[model samples]
Target: MGSGKRSDYLPEDERGASFAQIPTSFGHELRACLRCRLVKTYDQFRESGCENCPFLDMEKEHDNVVNCTTPNFNGIISVMDPARSWAARWLRIGKFIPGCYTLAVSEELPEEYQNICADNNVLYVPPKRT
Candidate 1:
């Protein structure tokens, strides 16, 4: 229970069922970073988000999945192709899991993907999920 003053001080907009509407579901491929190693889905893990896990920020939620059109890189340029980029680049795009953001490339790519990122200045590296 909370203190009376704290309860009363709670903003009206932040109260009641609106709080309940917030979604909190982990993905199937959810893993925890135990020590330096990445542990696969927890068999009997606690429900709430964990501060200790490195993968906490990387967890993918069901609401985030949408078809992304990714380009094919066959080591060529000057040809136009539209590869998939997540609509919500804020979510780190693909590479995580069901909603992962495993890939972290520089603003510009190296040899193979140079042309594509040249105009856009973004690169996509495939993520490795266990």
Candidate 2:
């Protein structure tokens, strides 16, 4: 997850097998694995289903790394209607409709987006959409 020239560090044998889900200027690479908390996207981490996941860090957390899902990320919660909004009433999503999720991930990303994807830093903190 470092010095790989970034682009959200996908290349764990191309996680999510080449992404492009059509959600705007840069809004969905969704990841939240901080030690297998599991919230993968980007075509479900390249269809290998996040193989050897070991909490891969697609970024947006900090404190170095430890199984890495960016320490249970704390930024994306974009539920639209798991049944009727209200933030999906504690979403446990099986199949989604409106997207962008990951909130109760066990806690970490608070220190200014932690490091914002340090080594492979592509820098997108609140900077995706145009």
Candidate 3:
């Protein structure tokens, strides 16, 4: 958190949470979580995994990161307050940690990963494509 401006938006307890850094500039390196749509750089995903979908255990797992994230996403929405932000609620990320998220992810989580979600009792809702 390091007293950064972004940490100011987070509650005191969550200021130290390990969410992805906001992309300085969008590019091919960016990827979105298939489950929560949290946006992060490919390297970031390898290093930190998805803050919202820790069950994926993507950190340091190349294949897991590849299978659980996608570069094909549209729009980025930064949510500072999940509980109160109308946009976060509309996007169905009200329970996710504060961070940059995709408006829509173009790909689906693999079937095996979907089963993992089920085993964990996490509902896996495919992103609406329109």
Best by TM-score: 3
Clash pairs, candidate 3, are: none
- Compute the lDDT of residue 66 as modeled in candidate 2: 28
TM-score of 1: 0.16
List the candidates ranked by lDDT, beginning with the highest: 3, 2, 1
Tens-place lDDT per residue, model 2, 1-130, is 4555634333445443222232233344555543223455544443433332313343322332323443235556555444476554544432233445555565443443335344334332331222
Best by lDDT: 3
CA-lDDT, candidates in order: 0.24, 0.40, 0.79
Q: TM-scores of all models? A: 0.16, 0.26, 0.82
* lDDT (tens digit, per residue) of candidate 1 on 40-78: 233212332222121222224221111111121111111
Which portions of model 2 miss their true places by more than 4 Å? 1-32, 35-66, 69-101, 109-116, 123-130
Give the TM-score (vs. native) of candidate 2.
0.26
lDDT by residue (53-82, candidate 3, tens digit) is 777889867799999999988899998888
TM-score rank, highest first?
3, 2, 1
- Worst ten in a row by lDDT for model 2: 121-130
The segments of candidate 3 whose C-alpha lies over 4 angstroms from its true place after superposition are 1-20
